[model samples]
Target: MTDRFRELVVNDSLVDIQYKTDPPTETVSPRVTYDRDDVPHVYCMKKTIPLSAFMERYARGEQRMWLAAYRPSNGRQTTITFAKHDRLTFGKRFIDAVAAERAHLFAPAQDSDGDASAPPPISSKKTAEVSSKAAKKISLEELELSLALQREIGRLGEDAAYRHEYVRLHALDCPNPAEHIVRISEDDVGAGYDMRSTFAGQTRYIEVKASTTRMDSFYISENERDTLAKVGQEAFIYLCRVDRDAPKNSAVVREIRDPMNPESGILLEAVAYKAKLSN
Candidate 1:
């Protein structure tokens, strides 16, 4: 047996044992029982023989054999048994066999070469080149669209009716009206395709789905989905039903929590509202 197996036995790491015959035979094999009263488990190693005469005395119970033991708390441990008659079979190869079986327990030490002591440094020119490339990679069209959405949201503050209604609803909770900023636009802020907001600070990211007709669902973009996950509970969805053909003052607004949920059925009512920012 290798030192690894000995160490495992001493440390009480043995878990379980299993045995199977190579070719079906009727001969009864010897068994080793291991029962520890302190550990509350009983195990056995059966059908194993000594290393001596393992090849020639197969019929006489001298075949090379292995035994596996297990501990309930640890895992499994294997010990090879040699038959008494097989002593000459392993004359010099015993050490080699032990080493081969226990290879996983041993590892060579690292060399103390000076080459591994220090790492190479980066140049200033290389650092500047990387920064320049990163700056150039930003999409101008995306930036312009974001800026346009932001500006449109800013214009909603000038709408007197929207401002008064927002103030009447939110003023009781928020004493400072100046802190509340109303923003309305087809802006992809959190979890919906378009969002409108009265107070960006007190109110979380509000996704707005606007339609001229009554609809059952709305759409959310990939970026909006990611933003919703990032924002978590601080995200909301608002559906604005605006009759562009009717009186402008009669627009209807409805609020829904977690509109991105698949069960919400908002995706069915999605319409193409794509627009680019212009100078």
Candidate 2:
């Protein structure tokens, strides 16, 4: 990734840093400016870093990047690729991506029964059916904590809801399905909203709450509430009740719009307070 960034800096005069995949230009290397010509949060240009200034600095940091990669390999830690399995990894979405790769490498040659054909594009059933034949590959300690599993379930809910919105709008013949709905949670972590859709043609900002146990309860961050207040009635919360055993089948069961409105009958509780030390 750092190498790719170096290529961009060396080749391009000025590069735009909008998405996460873009190089981390704001890493105190360049004469970076929060060079925004438009307002923040509406998907306009936010920050532009002058990479020419940091070309030397960034090039020098290649040593640090190599050290990071080398140490993890030598210490028997997860690789940078597998480290992204940060979610519940309760053997779900995170595994789904690398499942085929893992199976191809470790899985034994299967029986001829006309099944030794080319594999499908890494689905759960195929990965499991093929890999299950091997010896016990993963142990209990290799798994994440219960809380992390719960978070993974929550992510499953988010994934389900994201797909639903895109499909629902497309099925309903929304003029532009691509423009009408977007999964903001993937790209914009601090946007306070998970999705952007249309409600009666008005812009709808949606915050999704997916729980394995209860749909009625989930923590709301300060940014989420602020978005609800600012967006007014167009703001909504999609409750996705996920089934741990079957995450892919889960779907958004409820949609609450404008919870900030007293008539909507939703409540917010303050969980913690910050304090400043006496001067």
Off by over 4 Å in 1: 1-168, 171-173, 176-178, 182-202, 245-247, 262-279
What stretches of model 2 exceed 4 Å from their correct place?
1-88, 92-144
Q: How many clashes in candidate 2?
A: 0
User: Lowest summed-lDDT stretch of 10 residues in model 1?
Assistant: 83-92
Residue range 1-279, candidate 1, lDDT tens digits:
212222222233221111222223111122233324232121223533322222212212222434334323333343333322221122112223333432322223345762422222323332222144333221232233234333433233224334444655475675565455444342423434333344434455555545545746555676777665566555665555543223254333665556556664445344457788996
CA shift at 48, candidate 1, in angstroms?
Answer: 99
Every candidate's CA RMSD: 26.9, 18.7
Instruction: Tell me the whole-model lDDT of each prediction, alpha carbons only.
Output: 0.37, 0.52
Q: TM-scores of all models?
A: 0.30, 0.49
Backbone clashes per model, in order?
20, 0
